[model samples]
Target: MLDYHFQLTRPSLDTIAGILAALFVIYSVSWIIYTRFFHPLARYPGPFWASVSRFWMVSQIRGAHADKTQRELHAHLGSIVRIAPNEVAISDPDAIKTIYGINSGFTKTDFYTPWRPAWCRYPDAFTNLDEPLHASRRRITNSLYSMSSIARAEESIDKCTAVLLEKMASFAEAKRTFDMAGWAQMYAFDVVGQLFFSHMFGCLAAGHDHRGYIRSLDLLLPILCAASVMPTYIRSLFLIGGALVQPRVMKALTSLKDIDEAAEQCIAERHAQLEQGKSGDEKDILASLFAVMREKGEKVDFGRTEVKVEVYVALFAGSDTTAAAVSSVLYHLMKSPAVYKKLTNEIDEATRAGSLSSPIQYKEAAALPYLDACIKEGMRLHPSVGLTLPRHVPAGGCQIAGAWFPEGTRVGVNAAVVHRNRDIFGNDADNFNPDRWFGPDAARMDRYMFQFGGGSRTCIGKNISLCEMYKMIPELLRAYHIELVHPEHEWTTHNYWFNKPSNVETRVTARATGT
Candidate 1:
């Protein structure tokens, strides 16, 4: 009787497993057929697998070349490609002004929903999907991050730059080949730290991740990238597993929790310092945030929670993205010897003439035309963030890139695709020739930069990155002769969300006169 009961239950379990597998297969097949043939986006060009399921897009993103792959698809499929069952990636630069323009009526899609931290009262500017809220948040302290406002805090950037140069100077003296990309990111974090709390993280001084900031980014970006490709339920499953296992790990790994706690500490410390008259009158970004809240009153929705969330967002977004940009620029400069020489010559000339400050100034850097072209070319070649900003089409359907996109269709423009458009940037768009910005159609081409995005909803913290890049690059070039460790090979990069380059190992030699 016992043997008979065991046999009966085993078969019953096997039967149930078999039934579930068969049902899943049947459902998958039906879903694929419907999505590929009956879906509205079915008529559009895309990978058949992509049309069948979002898993195709997820796999592509996880494999870490979605940007390059999408670019190739657009090149083959023309300006538009159905990147998901409900989403289309439009490559034409003309799609920029139409989709992202002020009052274009295209609202940010759920793709950005995951970017907001769970602890925040309202989403920070980068992830805020609510139009009114985003606009209000931007209005509250947008001026504080403006190029003019950032330039006023030039000493903070200069301090960060000085620390970075000193580190590079050590590498030069020791004649050691170090990972410039890692150092660049470290320096960027320090810059944000200095700008935000009136003190650097001492990452450059210590020569490391410095409180596991970069490690948290390494962990966080992939999750955010996956969230873009997969369903929220699937993402929840991932987070659930991580939530269970991560906390139980032997070693204490840096997570978003660490960053949040640190941000809160920063808020308290800044408040104490302000109250004690310890903080100088220069007004760091945090100080400015407080000033806005006090002066504007409760009519403005900016509060302590909002300030903390902004701190976390700005620290990660400002540092990670800016680091990517700086790394890419430096890598491209290393790759293109002639262009690199030309830019350095311009900076050196300016420096020797006593026109440029020791660490360079944003205004002075802006005056260098070749340097300007190089920066633009670097960004165009490799946008810092290798992801599309998905926006939902409004009611009554609209046209884009000569194709009609129906209402509720998710549409976006990827810089990786749009920047390489042969029609706009010319036929040699894929190449790293800075002369494109100097061409007769330069003004027209300038409109398509799209790195900081376009129109009213553009990145509010963009000036912070530009402030650092414009000042730091010229100063670094003036200070050292940076040579790539592997000049013949392209620097290896991976795009989780930010298209960060990690293979930039370089040897720095101090420039006598400039130093």
Candidate 2:
């Protein structure tokens, strides 16, 4: 009777569920088969399983040290290698110009999409992809970052440098053991704040963690790593179900909100200055932006949104990157005392002649062959923003390394691979050798250095960073002697965005500088 009723009416609940499950299995299988065998991109050579396997690629990226993995793939597969069904990893140095150089039609892929905080009150410069929007925003503030303006801001740079020196001097006076990482990071934060917002983090005075800048950055690191490796679909799911499943995302969003709020306050202060009819040149980055806006017109089109984006970009590019480079350079210096001694002697001589503070300039500093070599070698050996900064090929498609890549293909040049190329750099490529950057070899080395990237998109702050390091390194060496507390200490680098230092502690001691 039950069977008769089931036949006469609708199917049983269990039977319906079984049919649905079977259909789902069939659809998934067919999709995989079609993608692997008949898809438009099937001709591209990659790992057989990875060609149609999103989960495989995600797992590979999620595994430990994905950057090194990409390097190995480049070594084995040559310049152009398929990393995933839609991703190609290019190791050729020329690709840098093609990908990130001026008028490169490629745009940032969805890899950066999840970096947007849910409660973000501003458009972060790092996350903006619309070319026109990016161009407009960059244009409004480009003058502020121009070489002439940066050169004129020398007084501000000197002031900040003095602040850093004073802080280091205090540490020298104490003769106490503390983490160099903390101090270096604090100096970076202070410099960025003073440069951009016309304030300081006061981290050095506190001799502890400052929640002002570092706190927000620390919270965002893991999410940045996770987003890079995990599938976008998965991240979207978390974002969509954020209310229920992703508490950490909510916390990060709140922290970003706090950061934006602080930036808005700074902008408000600038507006007040404008309202007060303050005239002439301004010192910090925001003031410069204001001056440009005023020159353009009294009623420039920027609202709070524009201010937020510019601030976030300044915060991201200025602070954390500076911190990473400084910390890594210091790490290499301390580990190799010979190198440290050479650098210190140069600084000592420069300071004795009063060049450390007086007339300290990026051009002059960049001319210091030893210091330049040390900086480049450090960046090459331990690139802070290691791994691939991915870009998507345009609709017409692209050709790389004598191979045809289809439209919409995700592509990136692995920095580590290019810098460590045995062909270009030799067998000791992995070793830190500053001498390789001296004399005739220096010109050759320039072709492969990928730390600041290349062409028009090369870091606008490279000049600024050079000036800061040129002054700071000399001053710090003159006052203090440092040894790695953990000689075996290693920083964590990933295939994600930034190569971050894992929490590490280093010891410091005072040096007797005969002043």
Q: How far off is residue 285 in model 2, in Å? A: 1.1
lDDT of candidate 1 over 244-331, digit per residue (tens): 7765221222466777777899998877877898875747888888887777748876678878887888776878788888888899
Clash pairs for candidate 1: none
User: Could you tell me the TM-score of candidate 1?
Assistant: 0.94
Which run of 10 residues does model 1 get worst, by summed lDDT?
246-255
lDDT, candidate 2, 1-515, per-residue tens: 99899886665777889999999999988977886777756655566666765555556545636567767777676677666667777887778878887688888787776665444543454565665666665566666667777776666666666776666567557755566656767777777777776667677667655565677766656555565555676875654466366787676556666676767777787787678877335578877666565566345566555665566666655766666777778888877889888877776687688665554666666666788888888778767676677888878988776777767888888777788877677778888788787757678778778887665456667766766676666556666677776777665544335665544465556666623
CA lDDT, candidate 1, residue 179: 88
Number of backbone-clashing residue pairs for each candidate, in the order shown: 0, 0
Q: What TM-score goes with each of the models?
A: 0.94, 0.87
lDDT score for candidate 1 against the true structure = 0.84
